[model samples]
Target: MNEYKIEDLLFEELILMDQEASDYEDLITQIGELAFEKGYVDKEFSKAVIEREKLYPTGLPTNKVKVAIPHAMVRDNVKKSAIIISKLKKPVLFKEMGSSTDSFIPVDIVFLLAVNGSKDQLTILQKLVGMFSDDDAMVKLNDMKTASDTIGVLKEILSQ
Candidate 1:
């Protein structure tokens, strides 16, 4: 579990404060390109994520804020263990996680996870779920005005 620090996996460069996307696929593509260009993920990362979302949606409908945690298997695709946090300009529809079908939600935030392996992914997902369940934390994230502010809030919540 000590393979990587939660705070260390966050990069200021990957904090997308105001992202605009027509749909979830577009959002993932934009974020994926950023990560790929930064050498964090491979070229096929975005496509893989989209496919995975179709089968196992990551859309999480939290109490205060709707969010999504999208990711693909590492499988040598991730060059670095970094999370790309994107605050969309507007909410986008996503199939809710654990839904059989016909269940969707408008997501305000996107957490594009580019981690090392299954172990790290599960650990980060647990931490993220805890953060999402916190009303105060989700509200704070929603109100963040800058990328650095987002990082600060995430570091504080994720560290706990």
Candidate 2:
């Protein structure tokens, strides 16, 4: 079995769609509130992620899909750790990581992330990035209608 299970990292309460946000902070606030309500992290998580993202944007534009894996080192503020997967109702502009000119692009799929430790975060992130790099996986992930479906796909991929 995989040491890190996607099912364990993902939860029904953390999956959401049909949210509308005009900017980065707006979306992070909405995501952070849900995670806070579920007792995964504190209210400061949103601010932390927003601040971190400004310095290190996580927007990844793939051949199949566009995504942003937003996260923070919120060890001081985190109560627990969980990952939130969401699809925005509309694409929001985010600065690309390592961009010299500060270019920005629209990102629709976002992975709002939290992890208890650096080791755990690295393990989970590696699994997620490898999976998301697959064209088929990204297509299916974008097509998922429910959280269960998303979990199922990740479970299947990560279990390999």
Pick by lDDT: which candidate is best?
Answer: 1
Q: State the C-alpha lDDT per candidate.
A: 0.90, 0.81
Candidate 2 per-residue lDDT, tens place, 1-160, comes to: 1456555887877888667987988998899998998899888889999999988998876668778888996666677777898887888888886788778768878887787777778787787788778989888877888878877876787778
RMSD, each candidate, Å?
0.9, 1.9
TM-score of every prediction relative to native:
0.97, 0.91
Clashing pairs in 2: none
Q: Candidate 1 versus the native: TM-score?
A: 0.97
Worst 10 residues of 1 by lDDT: 72-81
Model 1 local distance difference test score: 0.90
By summed lDDT, the worst window of 10 consecutive residues in model 2 runs over: 1-10
